[model samples]
Target: MTMTIAFAGTPTIDDAPGIDWREQAACRNHPEPNLWFPVGINDPCDDAKDICVNHCPVRETCGLVANRTRERHAVMAGFRCSDPDEFIDLRIWLGVENPARRTRTCRHCGVKFSTRHPRRRACPECRDLVPLEPVHRHIQHLRNVGKYTLRGIAAASGVSVGTVSLLAKGQSPYEGPYVSRAIAARLFAVTTEQEAKTA
Candidate 1:
């Protein structure tokens, strides 16, 4: 029996001698290389599997090698095939499977619906009710009266510096269509607190 082991930072097969099967493996140089390992009967890392299935150039070759060698316990060609039967199933799943479109429950309306995009968490009905303009106006007011920096507004409002910068420039978070209620509430609370302190 011949065991082939490749280490991180090792030169790819194209750059080195011999035709290492791992040369075109997408798991190479991955931060969590061990995500390739199977947890029970399923591939533990969906992201890693997606990379191997979609991006890996040598997926078929790697799968063939793993199947022939009866390699169990580790992910090969994006499949967590522990046995020959599982390998066949993995092949079938890879060919036929389509990822289910993700959906999010609206935080405000208690309604669930499919979103056109992943970042759109709120339902369309509640999108107009988010009340971001007042929060934007209050943030500007704080900056003008209290001389608050972007970092200061972020600290006070419990959001990221980038978010505060966006609001300061009349932009939305992540350039998204809606502002989260938590952000508006926090900004309002901070503004009220500042007003109380001054009064």
Candidate 2:
């Protein structure tokens, strides 16, 4: 029996009658094949993706197949549709329903905006409004001059020992659920008082 893959706008049959469609994939020759299957959201895949998508001759076909099959993992045609909803959004942006239209609704503010990057969910306005990293020096001061241990800082300011450790080590103190401004202010006041007593 002959099998045909159907894309949203057009259908293309796999060339070798009985063979699987993936056998004809353009990314089959990649050096680090596992790089395509990134484990985390922040994992680096751009180098492999560039070869698989931009350099591949069958990128469009790959995208069509990926979208049709509702692929949840792996990059296809430079797009990583992590879920069915993301695939639908990709199709809409690809102009499956309307060829002339190419826009995506921002995940944050629900504003429609044009984007060449398929993975971009937020509009420029919302992207710019994202919070900047907190100043690490405030935490450093407590550790350096105030001589506060991680446990001591955690006890005094109610910030976690892990966060205090990161700050003391000159690492990202503001990553993830970090010390709040109120807690930081309290720590700053405590450090200032310590500084005054030692002076």
Clashes of 2: 0
Q: Each prediction's TM-score against the native?
A: 0.36, 0.44
For candidate 2, write residues 1-199 as lDDT tens digits. 2212222223354434575556555566455665666654445567756776557776666676677776677666666565344465567645573434359986544569986554666565543321123436766666677776778877876555775566555554333423334445545555645667876
Tell me the tens digit of each residue's lDDT in model 1 across 100-130: 5567886544579774343456565444334
Taking all chains together, the TM-score of candidate 2 against the true structure is 0.44
Cα lDDT of all candidates, in order?
0.62, 0.57
Candidate 2 C-alpha error for residue 21, in Å: 5.9
State model 1's lDDT: 0.62
- Return the top candidate by lDDT: 1
List ranges where model 2 is wrong by over 4 Å: 1-24, 83-89, 97-121, 124-199
Instruction: Return the lDDT, model 1, position 8.
Output: 32
Error of 2 at 5 (Å): 18
Compute the lDDT of residue 135 as modeled in candidate 1: 69
